[model samples]
Target: MLTRIVTGLALIVLSGLYWLQADAIPQSPMSGSVGADGLPKLLALVLCGLSLIFVVQSILVRQPLAAPGIPEDDQDEDDAAFTRRGHVLAGALLAISIVYSVILPYAGYTVAMGFLLLAVGVFYHRRMSAGIATFAILGAVVFHLIFITLLGVRMPEGIWPNVLAFLHAHTA
Candidate 1:
């Protein structure tokens, strides 16, 4: 019941923000038939619909909810544990992303992505050697192909750009 209520409230807030952003979206040459805001608006509408359904179901099922199987004291402990783990993972990911953004301008796509992937894998407790090797190789290859080769999108070229360029030239 509490979960449902909280989820519904979050959905409501997100939907409102999406709607407002959609409304404020300016016209652009790149605007396709649906435009920049279409997908977000559609997603927000779906979330709102789901939230309404959940609210209605919660209201209809008027059963007094017991504290989930755990004892009340244990439940608080479990919740805290869960929250701490979530925060740790979230913070790690956020830090990696921020570093990627900052370094991309200097390091170029391949190196920056390699570092980001390695950081994320290590942060998640993957075996260090395997994680670093796998993510570094995979991230560099995949993102280089997608953004640089296929999409023709420009990526940052910092100190590491020459290294990436050399690799690409030889490999290609």
Candidate 2:
């Protein structure tokens, strides 16, 4: 299938990039045994290997490569069930990701993620009260668990951090 071909090509490109960058990475201060580029290089090598396997499998199987499934020019009644608004919502979600990336460092992960969640809920026609409540709790917990706890990445301390500090001071 065309997907396999694209995946193979992408893997090849990624492997090349990793191989090229492996030599340029500086030594990591936290882990002196491994360089900064070590993880990427390993990932690239794995991707290359997997891609090669896929390519060979496709060839051996003799399966004809086909492009992604595109619907015929005639719009079916089932297709009409999906509204333009659905597409708009999808586009909005994508835009929110782009905006979140830009705002994350300055606004902090919690705030940016909170706003993104609320925006998505609103786009999908959820009520404001329910959306805000869900967004606040879910966004904060998920982002914290993923980026802070699991990934061991430090997120910026924006307004929410100050609010937490204030609460702690008051409680103590």
| Top-scoring candidate (lDDT) | 1
The local lDDT score (0 to 100) that residue 91 gets in candidate 2 is: 80
Off by over 4 Å in 1: 21-50, 62-83, 124-155, 159-172
Number of backbone clashes in candidate 2: 0
lDDT of 2 by residue, 53-134 (tens): 9777756756543557855334577665467876776686899788878887767877777877777667566667775768
Q: State each model's CA lDDT, in order.
A: 0.79, 0.76
Q: What lDDT score is found at residue 134 in candidate 1?
A: 87
Off by over 4 Å in 2: 27-43, 64-91, 97-118, 126-172
Candidate 1, residue 18: Cα displacement in angstroms equals 3.9
| Structural similarity to truth (TM-score) of each candidate | 0.47, 0.43
Whole-structure CA lDDT of model 2 = 0.76
Per-candidate alpha-carbon RMSD to the true structure: 8.7, 9.9
**lDDT by residue (tens digit), candidate 1, 43-149:** 88998888888777767766655668744322444465457778887787898899999998887778888888787778767668875778688988899999989
